[model samples]
Target chain A: MSTFIQQLANGVSLGSIYALIALGYTMVFGVLKLINFAHSDVMMVGAYVAFFVATGLNAGPDPSIASALITFLAAMAGAAALGIAIERLVYRPLRSASRLSLLIAAMGMSLLLEYGGQVVFGPQHRRVPDVITDERIVLGDLNLTVHKLIILGVSVVLMLGLHFFVNKTRTGTAMRAVSQNVDAAKLMGVNTDFIIGLTFAIGSALAGAAGLLVAFHQQGDIDPLMGVYPGLKAFVAAVLGGIGSIYGAMLGGLLIGVAETFVAAYLPSSFRDTITFSILILVLLVRPAGLLGKFKPEKV
Target chain B: MRGAAIKLGFLVVLVGAAIGIDFALREIFNPHWLRLIELAGIHVVIAVGLNLINGYCGQFSIGHAGFWAIGAYASGVLLTVAEQKWGTPSAVVEILLLVGGMAIAAILAGAAGLLVGIPSLRLRGDYLAIATLGFGEIIRNVIVNVDAIGGPRGYHGIPVYTNAAWCIIVAALAIWFSRNLVTSSFGRALVAVREDEVAAEAVGINTTRVKVIAFVVSAMMTGAAGALYAHLDGSLDPDTFKFTKSIEFIIMITVGGLGSITGAVFGAIVLTLLPELLREIHPTLSEYRMVIYSALLIVIVLVRPKGLLGNRELSPSAGIAWLRRKFGKGTA
Candidate 1:
């Protein structure tokens, strides 16, 4: 039915955002093996930056393509800088510390961003300037919107660009090498710290893009805590797709988005969160390594 | 046998003294301060239980709020039913009902812990954290869906049976249990597992069983604390048992020193009192309280990674040994 098509379209658009956020989580997790709890906060920061930029530019409800591009670019740049700073300041110093210490530090970093955001941005919701018009496009019985198209197009383009960059670029290869074996990568004269920072930068930029799109999609829904649920759900997506796998995170995000949308449509709305989490537990129980993650037997 | 009897007698005296002080303080201090002290004790119970899981067992399970919620709702439902079945009970019967409710809460929470623990047996580090996080959200969702217990709106009018004396007694018991647990051979097994899981399994430690046991015991204690919290507040809100609350408990144990019962107790009391202390100082300061709290956490981890106590118990014998070492041979 047309409703099914509409739902699928909506799910994919949501999934694209989740995929973008999950990329950051997966990439950082790949290099550092830390959960990077603050990554979600970084996404929040990105959304806020875009909000300010668009507002500063006086972009009304229907901004031009140029203005939207500038907004996205500024947000991504700001977020990337933050990511590198977090790595250098908070994480890098604790490189040799215990796992518990690292995790707690990460948590502290997350809280600092969230509460600090409340302090800086105020706790109230800010309606994002409409980057794109919310005009509906009717294709026979299917209902589509400009927001959905923009989300899909931008996400696809970015994902393709990222895929090529990670697969083909020398810097990306060096990044992969560091993730596999830090010492080995260092031995090969790779600047491991720089690569790690670069990983954070790239991952955070993706999250920034995701944040901007989400803000645009859910006009007037931007807030300090907006990233928490999406961040968590995206994390579940990363895990479901087998964390550390780029393609897996993408796959997982889409699957979760579709499943969540379908569940919301069919079941009592309250069960939406429960179902998402249930999938995570089920995946973890069945395949602890995640969908795309390889199982490594522990060495004594 | 004499040593066991002496220890028992000492605990009994300590508890009796606490109860006496609690009553005396009520007559002297304002209700506000008294409530803070009671809440501090409750936090101690939860913190100690969390330490047993995260610190001793080396399993980072952050779904503690789920267990706490379970205990609170269970106690709330029971007390509500009891009040309906038999109007207001006599003083003695009221005490019995509260104790019975706590026991049931602990049992239910412990059972839920077992369910969560089995799934966690296969996970480690961040993965375990995520699964536990998921379980916590699931619990909150389930609570919201159940219409009988007020669901999202939360339960109200639970009997107020919790007090400073009750809180102190339970907190003392929690500390005692954790101390005994960490010092025993089983405790050694847990430490071994924390240090290295594969090595512990190689040395014949049933890692799975140890983890599950830790989860059950920790959940049980937290559940009891939840019951006390319910009775103290006379209400239950599902929102109270969110991931953020679990993070608060984790922060307490981390600040106090993981795997140290005394550290957990110390951390719990200090943290519970901190917000109140800030509020007393100034409203603006309290507004930025969480920021300060988080910064302190980072600084502590950066400075003393093992936490303040660093897996060391704070006891008289240890204090004496420390004093002797510090002051050369003459101090003893």
Candidate 2:
């Protein structure tokens, strides 16, 4: 029972990170109908930014709550700027082209960020200093790390904030209107570009937070290739939950995290990736629209 | 009659000049140049095969490298292990063994393609891309875990039989097959599906059949390229056939006009050479190769969305017209 509880905690913490990143993917897909492959790399950029800020300021080698908050804020800002710039420069020009063209461009953007990060940061891994050093809490053989609790707590706060923002704010209403019908939203005089840009910024900031949270949970190590696996997993979560549904992205992320953890723990590590992908393929084959996704016919 | 004679004469001259240049270059340049040419030729085969599925059929498959790895390993295991088991090792027998190995690999990769294509074809666009990407990852993981094929450590000790003559022969065969396939009735159906699947289906075209056929053919050719790659390298590693490698193949297809054979060849040659040239200029540029390549890809798409050739193939008559324009009609 204790082992199960520990696994459940691990799953939720991991799932929280996946859910955060997957929300960005699902939101972009909902609004633009384009799979932004570069979003994953943006998350990578966020982690690197936070790593540099924490290390350069000597905040990490000596753990301090104030420094962590400042670094996290700086990372979020940097990621938001990068996201806005990418949308304006690379993707905005090809907005009128076929989805394939946009997809190719997104991939190009992804490669650029990944390799450019390699060039600037070097290929080696940099460790993030642990700012949270609280002792593990033991409850009758169920030991939970404080870092995991922080990750789960931060993720919940972010998700709730997003929910409130999307459901309550005027811009969120505009975003929903555009996603439901771009032409009708335009007819209603909504500034599509601004909404789109804001969506990317908000989504990218969430990814940035997720990156930092993950860094904390893993003890603050960042590398150029760190984004690829998590990116692919988040994409899988998005697909499994329902590509364009925000709530679905969250659910999918959590389910995939649990599934992956359980599979890895039970099955051989070699078969772990295969099992995860097999589940995706099976899910896709059974429900083309995904688990929580509802199918809407394309506009002819 | 005059036009026909002019076309025939131009073709003859072009073929003669090409052969002359090939022979001259062979004599003047060292073996390294020949090797590069051979490598480019193999990539041409792979890229052209990818073009049929991605460019012509409008399917986004990022798993070509998985099939390539399958073909390489399949052929490598047969040629090396099977030869040892049999113990004959005669030249004719070895030739037959190699051919058999290649055929089997093609068949296996083609079958794998069918398995991936059947379910994926039901969805449109990005979903298909994700499915194919998943398939590639699955293949990589399976290869890494399977101990029989040496797993992640890779396979070695395959006899090297890839040569200039074999590379040229394979390139010619692939080009001819792809060109003929694109111009035939089946090819027209593929283009129709690519343009509008619903419209094609309304017009009685079996979109699924056409897609499956093109996918299988593409896989077979990619497998053949893999066989050649295995022989050239004399070893096969799982790392060589990763998602990035598949993206490289996609890059070749994208830069080359989708439906143009000549574009694939041009893309394969230029991209292959550009990296080598960049490496020679500055060693640090090697690390930034992917960054530069991706940036150039984005810029090219924004600037010329239709690609360099835009569905046009190079022809002897076009070459003669260019020559005549350059020489001003009285050079002879």
Candidate 3:
């Protein structure tokens, strides 16, 4: 029972990270109908930015709460700026092309970010400074790390914040309007570009937060290739939940995380990735629109 | 009469120049030029095969490397295990085994494609992209876990059978096959399906069949390239056929031009050569080569979204004729 609970906790923690990054992917897809393949690298950029900031300030493994907060904000801001720049420079120009063209371009941008990051940061892993170092709390045989609790708590809060922002804000409504029908949204005088850019910024900020949380949880080891697997897993979560549905991405992330953890525990570790991807393929085959996705027939 | 003479003269001069360059490279370089030619040939095969599905049929498949891996392993296993276990096979027997290996790989990869394609064909653009991407990942993972094929350590000790001559022959065969395919009735149906699936279906064209056929054929061709790659490298590693390699193949097709066979060859050659030239400049730049390559791809797509050739075939005859008119019989 304790093993099950521990697995559950690990799944949720990993799922939360996947959910946060998946939100960015689903949001970009929802609004622009383009899969930003570089979004994973964007998350990597966020983690690295936070790493640099924490190290620059001499913020050791255990930093003051205020310093941690300041470092996170600075890192998120840098990530947001990078996201905005990529959108404006690389993707914005190809807005009118076929989806295939955009997909290829996004892939190229992904490679650019990954290799560029490698070149700049060097192709080595950098340890992230641990901000939270409290030990685990044992409750009868279920020992839960304080860092896990913090990650879960912060992730839930951020998710709720995103929900409120997308559902309640004027810009959020405009974003919904554009996603529903860009031509109709444009006809109604909504600035499509502004909404798209805002969506990218918000999505990337969430990725940044997730990145920081992951760094803190993992004790701050960062690598140029760190984002690739997580990014792919997040994408899987996004698709499994429903590609353009925000809530669906969250649910998908948790489910996948749980599924992966259980499989790893029960099955051979070698088969973990294979099992996860197999689940993705099976889910896609069964429901092309995904668990929460709606299907719209292709327009001639 | 003058035009005809000029065209003939230009052809002679062009052939002379090509031979001259080939001989010069043989003398100056340490067999590196041959290797480059082989690389270009392999890429041409991969790119052209991808063009059939992604370019002509308008299906977005980023999993070409998965099929490539399948082919490489199939060929590698045959060359290493089968020959030793059975007998000292003759040259003819070995050749037949290699071809059989390629066929089996194509069949296996094609089956995998069908598994992914049948249900997901109903999904549009980005969704299909995700499905294919997932399939690619699944293939990689499966290869990693399966111990029979040496798992992640990869298969080695395969006899090195891929040479410049073999690469050129395979490339020539691929190009010829694709050219014939795109001009046939079946090819027109593929084009129709690409243009508008609904309309094509209404007109009695089996869109699903066309899609499946194109996808399977494309997978097979990519598998052939993988077979060649395995032989050339004398070993096969799963990491070499990752998602990144798939993306590189996609870049070749996109930067070359979609729906153009000639564009595939041109793009593959130029992109392959550009990196090789860069590598010659500085070894460190080789690590940063993908960054530079991708940046150039982005810039090119932004500036000319339709690609360099954009559905146009290279007209060697026309080029020769123009050159002859300018150079006045090539001073002959």
Candidate 4:
């Protein structure tokens, strides 16, 4: 019973990272209607940036909150820059092109980042410096670590901030408008391009934070290709929650993370991924538009 | 009757040419070059199969590697079982075994395709792509857990039945089959569906049935290619069928030009050889080969969104026609 609660805690911590990444995928898919396969690679880039910053600052053997904050900011900024660059360069030119073209372009961008990362980062797995202290909190049978607490706290705060921003801010309103109808938004005097770029920036910034959190979770075992699996599962989370629904992305991520954790605990560890995917298929089967997504019939 | 005779004669010439080249290459070129050629042929089969679904049917699938892996393991297991049952059979038995293995691979892989396709084909475009991707990963994970087929250690000791003759002949047959398929009425229906699904449905075309057929056939072709790949490599690893490998095939068709059979073949050949060419230029340069290819992909998408060939054939006749048109000498 204690183990169950412990597993639940572990799952939520993992799920938080997935939620952050899924937010990026859902948002990009919302506005641009493009998958942005490079989103994962962007997360990878953020992690690498954080790695460099943490290492360069010599955050030292001891964990410091200031250093971690600095590292997070640096990575998020770098990732935001990259996200905007990808949209401006790769996606912008093909705005009027077919969805297939956009998808392929996005894939190309993904491969470019992955392989280019290999070339730039030299394919070596770099150990991330400890920016957070290794402290654990025990509550009766349940044990929680400082790292896990930080992950949950940061994720919740960020999500709430995003919620407020999207609901209250002008830019966020423009983003919502563009996603609802790009041409209509343009007619209403919104800079559709700027909104889309900003969407990428915000999404990518979230992915960047997810990257650092994930690095922290794994004790800084970072690599160029580290983003592939997490990225894939996150994309699945985005889809599972309903691609265009931000709240759905969060819920789906947490659901998948918890389900995966339970499966790993109860079933053969190899079945963890298989079970997670099966759940996705089943959910998709029942709810085609996803749990939170509203289905709009195609206009003939 | 005259046309039939000419077509028959052409097939004979093509097969003969393939066999002759296989033998001649064995004598002329080293085994390394021969392997590369064989690998390119395998990619050609895969790319064409993928094109049938993605290009013609307009359904996106990045899980083709799953079907390919299924075919490979099917054939590998079949041959392994045969060897255990009958020790070192004669030449006739060897030929039979190879044919039987490929047939089994096709059937099993096709069934697997049907299983995945039926459920997922209901989804549109990007959703379908994601579902298939998930299915592919599930397949890989399943393969790893099953211990009878070597699991994560990889299935080894598979006999090498694939030669240059087999590669060329199978690739030619696959391309021929796909060409015929795309040119037929069903092919027209597929193209129509790709152009507009709602209109196709409105026109009384069963979009679902057409899509399922395309998906199954494509899966079968990919499976056959996987069988060939297994024999050629003499080993099967689940890792080889990862999602990234599926992306590689997508790159091929997209680079060559989707919906163009000749483009698939051309793209497969160029991509397979590009790394080798880079290595020849500089051993270290091969490390940057994927970076170059990906950059090229982006450039192609930005400059010429329709790809290099853009659904056009690049056959000898077409080439000659193009040349004549360019020179303003023939037909005009």
Judged by DockQ, which candidate is best? 1
Against the native chain B, what TM-score does each candidate's chain B reach? 0.95, 0.87, 0.85, 0.95
Which regions of candidate 2 fall more than 4 Å away from where they truly are?
Answer: B1-34, B321-332
> After superposition, which runs of candidate 1 have C-alpha atoms over 4 Å from their true positions?
B1-15, B329-332
Error of 2 at A130 (Å): 1.9
Deviation of model 4 at A171, angstroms: 1.9
lDDT of 3 at A122: 89
* Candidate lDDT (C-alpha), each: 0.89, 0.84, 0.83, 0.90
CAPRI tier of model 4: medium
Q: Clashes in each model (backbone N, CA, C under 3 Å)?
A: 1, 1, 2, 0
lDDT over C-alpha atoms for residue A50 of model 4: 94
lDDT, residue A255, candidate 1:
89
The predictions' CA RMSDs to the true structure, in order, are 1.6, 3.9, 4.9, 1.6
lDDT of 3 at A273: 80
- Clashing residue pairs found in predicted model 2: A128-A220
Report lDDT (Cα) of residue B163, candidate 4.
Answer: 88
Tens-digit per-residue lDDT, B100-191, candidate 3: 76677677777777787777776656555777888888888888888998898988888776666567667777887899899999999988
Q: Candidate 2 chain B — worst ten consecutive residues by lDDT sum? A: B10-19
Most lDDT-accurate candidate? 4
Error of model 4, residue B87, in angstroms = 1.4
State model 1's lDDT: 0.89
Q: Please, what are the lDDT tens digits per residue for candidate 3 over residues A4-105?
A: 988888889888989999999999999888889989888889999888888887778557787678777876787788889989988888888777778778
Residues A191-273, candidate 4, lDDT per residue (tens digit)?
A: 99899999999999999999899888898899999999899889888888988999999998998888888999999899988
